[model samples]
Target: MNLHADAVTVLSAWAPSLGSQESLRQAFLGFLATRDDTVQRSCEAGHLTASAVVLDSTGTQVLLTLHPRVGRWLQLGGHCEPSDASVADAALREATEESGMTGLEIGAAPVHLDVHPITCSLGVPTRHFDVRYAVRAPAGALPVRSDESDDLRWFPVDALPAGSEDLAELVNAAVSSH
Candidate 1:
């Protein structure tokens, strides 16, 4: 299937809140409009990326990246490329790449979605419309930090690290979504 068709299929399957193709198309277009320059370029160039939050079987634990630049623990995700046929694929790909965990299994549906402004090392503004998904890793699978993260650790859902209220809310929502 083609990119647009694949996107339609995935969205139709997952986002039942969207009632029709026209609504889904509008939603997608609305998502596109919210992107910053970097993300806009990526989408225009057809290189949109995604990410996911991986949890253990009990759902009490979550894997987080200590972002090098942001200096905070966050879910694994990144830019979408041409190879990623669907948003879910992009999210799962980023999670695996960043966490270095094998046998990653992403849920068929998104747990939540959020858009936030990000400025890269060069101070270029970008908007990330993160399609956060619930994912599971094999038991005993250890996470190795990639260059994107200074450290990788599992945090208990009840005891999130110190951060902005917004982040706390996002984390809570993700946890509850599972």
Candidate 2:
């Protein structure tokens, strides 16, 4: 199935970790039911984005990218692309592209769901309904920073950036799910 259909299937079957997430999941499914283009960036109303919290082989370190545009550390992910076959593929693709790491394995189900507003590449205010997964980097895999990142580094699960609550929560969800 296509990414749009796969998103519906995946989220429909997913179990939310928090009470708040269930409403967001319902919203996502509702959006998908109305628009075929919800998976693409062109849908200005808001779109689905896939991201992953990159956990090290040992699950002690989390890889984060200091997004040049947002000027903060975030999970490895981005807008879903036409080439993406599924949400999981998009998450893994973004993780590999931004982290420059290979042999990454993504969990079969999402670890969390989040929606936030931003002026992304579209250059207009938009909302990103993010589907987040937990990904495992290969043992001894070293990361190289991409042009998309101001910095790409791993932080101990307990030592995430001082003010990043979202990152901390994503890490917590990913670690707990693992």
Candidate 3:
């Protein structure tokens, strides 16, 4: 089967397991089956990627981003690219690039998997399959803003900004697992 067909097959098999949040599930399945060359190229080029949930010294605080485009606070992450040798590497790279924190230690297991819709300049939606990993931020690390984010800050797991429930859950899971 072709890539699109294979993607569809994979999506169909997994869609039933996605529970509610039908829109998110459908978009995720659609993303898996996308035949658009641009989208395919983006994924293939590693521009469609994964990310990390960096926990600070106390493990009570998690670093997050105030996204400029989506205008929402979220975990630091981005697309996986050709230079990334592995999924963990992609997550680490995105964390470093987006948060400017060095000496990050990525966890061995994925805490959660989420798919979100991102609309670019032309108002077309792209899907991001975020594979979230738990990570430890370097001691005394300070988060700095990058091109992808407007601001970076650390927030307590239970006291995250409004609308950050999903991120908070993921971060909490990661922390608990550790």
Error of 1 at 10 (Å): 3.5
Residue 149 of model 2 has an lDDT of 95
For candidate 3, write residues 39-99 as lDDT tens digits: 2325431123467888997798988899898798988877655555556677888898888
Model 2 compared with the native: what TM-score? 0.97
Q: How far is each candidate from the true structure, as Cα RMSD in Å?
A: 4.7, 0.8, 5.5
The full ranking of all candidates by TM-score, starting with the best, is 2, 1, 3
Question: TM-score for all predictions?
Answer: 0.76, 0.97, 0.73
Better of 1 and 3 by lDDT: 3
Ranking of candidates on lDDT, top first: 2, 3, 1
Q: Kindly list the per-residue Cα lDDT of model 2 for residues 1-178, writing each as its tens digit.
A: 9999999999999988698888989999998999899999999999999999999999999998898888898999999999999999999999999999999999999998989999998999999999999999999999999999999999999998866766777798999887
Q: Is 1 or 2 the stronger prediction by lDDT?
A: 2
- Give the 10-residue window scoring lowest on summed lDDT in candidate 3: 38-47
Displacement of the residue 43 alpha carbon in candidate 3, Å: 5.0
lDDT of 3 at 173: 70
Clashes of each: 4, 0, 4
Stretches of candidate 2 off by over 4 Å are none
> Which candidate number has the best lDDT?
2
For candidate 1, what is the lDDT? 0.67
lDDT on C-alpha atoms for all candidate structures: 0.67, 0.93, 0.67
TM-score of 1: 0.76
